[model samples]
Target: MVNNNEKDKSSQVTEFSKEAGYYLQKGVHCLNRSQLKKALKYFRKTIETDPHNTYTHYNIAYILSRIDYLKDINETFQEILGTTYNLPEASFLAAIYYSLTGEMDLAEKELEKFLEIAPEGEIMEEAREMLNLLSGEEEIYENLSYIKLSEKYEGVIQTVKEKVKRNLECPFFRVKMLENLYQLDDDLTSNIIFLYGLAENSTIAERVLRHFIKSSWAKEMHKELAMLALRDIGAEEPYEVMMENRIVKVTLKEYFERIPQWEPQWYQVMEKALENIKYNKYHSKTMEGELKEVWNQYIKVAYPEIPPVRDINLWSAALEYLTFKKRGINLNHKEISLKYRVFPEELLEKYKEMGQALSR
Candidate 1:
């Protein structure tokens, strides 16, 4: 039922829409790569090409909000909301902007609307917390260090206590939580020692041994476990405090014969030893020489394509490159890469190629 002029206009509109879609895809790709300036440019082009596109407006608003382009953010967000788009994400962002600007009433209203629209949204928990905070139902201590520590450690303490009270036999879980707590505050030496005593698993014991070797509390409360752990892990150093405990010495000797004597595979051993050394931990030094020898053997066997290099620096690079190629893990040293005039993007592409080849 269309005339020739109308048909030509329709064809032109279709072509423009296709071009706009291409620009939109480019914008999204740039955004994903964190190229904020390029993304904004492409998005603005998309707006020029297709002024009625709500998604383009939303994305531009999001970028502007992140960059604190406060003058334009509200207008852009309002444009998105004015459209027929059901944008709960926009509402959430608007709420955050309002909160930042000290417009509490507006922020509360936007958050409430966001909840009503998307009750099971990704930011629901954060929204609820913010609402509680805004309503003064929950206290947010700004300057109290003790209150902050109490808040941080309370959940861990409560979970462990509840498990203990219920007579739940999840030693692994208890020890894992204790390990996290220990990492948070090494001053919780007594608490960790108590939990370690109750758990006594080999994994937990090793973690405790690595972290608390110098702790007086650990030596006083967990001497037996520490001695047994060190012995199991083939530690050469003797603990003076543990040696003074007659029961610990006797127990250590009893368990010494039962510990496994097998070694892990060369690659795994090399990785673990290197990681420990990287962290300035000396627990893996006994295997360093053997690990270097194994690395040479591995390079000779697995990476025949790479030329042989005898220098430790070149050897390290070869090892890191081959490991990355084989396992898709980025073991390449950033400083070394800079020395060699290589870039992270180049390494990423190499890794991607390796992954694709493996998939084939």
Candidate 2:
């Protein structure tokens, strides 16, 4: 009874539906293996192949809900909530999405709706947990049938601890943990690190961060956190940071003192020594910068009580030795002493002073 054109259109629609089903199956398979990127790609194919199938969109949001590290599905959440009423889980996804975006009121409403509609589902407990976290009665993250979030945050915590003990050249996440912590979900901060922040005893933590700031290896946040650490302890009103990017100044109720300054002659003699050993020519800026940082840090600790610049060539030799030691690059003292035409014991004496000052 139908025309050939109508028949062709019907055939094409059926084929597209089959293709969408195939992509949906493949996407779920990848998701079971924790391959989020691949799953998202296949899910996108399903959407593109069957644009009229609104349930496909809901499925995507439902699967991805509360995974805050992933990108937000803002309009998708709104569309599923406003227009699509069949899937109660759309409300669940909306709750997590809104919470991540800092709309606590909207998140609470969505969670309330989700709890009312979906009394029994895979994520019913997760929804309840989220509601509790929003009320400040508990933390937001939950253990689910699929993803174990507690283990994941626990892993990040372990790696961060090892890195803290090993190198002061910290990654950005560590700095984020120390600052702007309220922006993060609760599971991320459930450790001694957050405890220190709460106790306002960032003394040991701040000392380590100060070393990071003074090191040549300091990144941008390292510089900023050093100043903020001062404010946290009721230390100083105005602090000067050596690294100049954009200037920022804030006062916190804490205690701190001004940082120490090194004599310019120390750097000049160190550069001359670096040239003597052909160190500057090989790694010119690195050799100079590292020596300057080590010299200044020792000065910071032992300032006013620091020794006078006598027989600066001997001190230059010691400065070069200390810089290498700070980097965990061992240089033979006898070898370094000879290179600077200084006696080994005299260089050792100066080097010992530098090391002892930092240990304080």
* Candidate whose TM-score is highest: 2
lDDT of 2: 0.55
| Model 1, span 143-202: residue lDDT tens | 222222212211222243343323324565545545543454433443344333333344
lDDT of 2 by residue, 1-360 (tens): 999888767766766776676567556555545556666667667766775543354345434443334444564344334434456766765665565445778878988998898788657776776677677684423221222222222112224234433332344534544553332433332222322222233455555434434444444333433444444444445443334343334332111123332366665676666666464223444454566557667776787797788787888888888877887778888988887889999999999988899899
Q: What does each candidate score in C-alpha RMSD?
A: 22.2, 23.6
Query: Once superposed on the true structure, which residue ranges of model 1 sit more than 4 Å away at CA?
Result: 1-71, 76-87, 142-325, 328-360
User: Which 10 successive residues of model 1 have the least lDDT summed?
Assistant: 148-157
Q: Candidate 1 — what's its lDDT? A: 0.46
- The local distance difference test score of each candidate is 0.46, 0.55
lDDT of 2 at 268: 69
Q: Pick the candidate with the highest lDDT.
A: 2
Candidate 2 residue pairs that clash: 233-254, 233-255, 234-253, 234-254, 234-255, 235-254, 235-255, 235-256
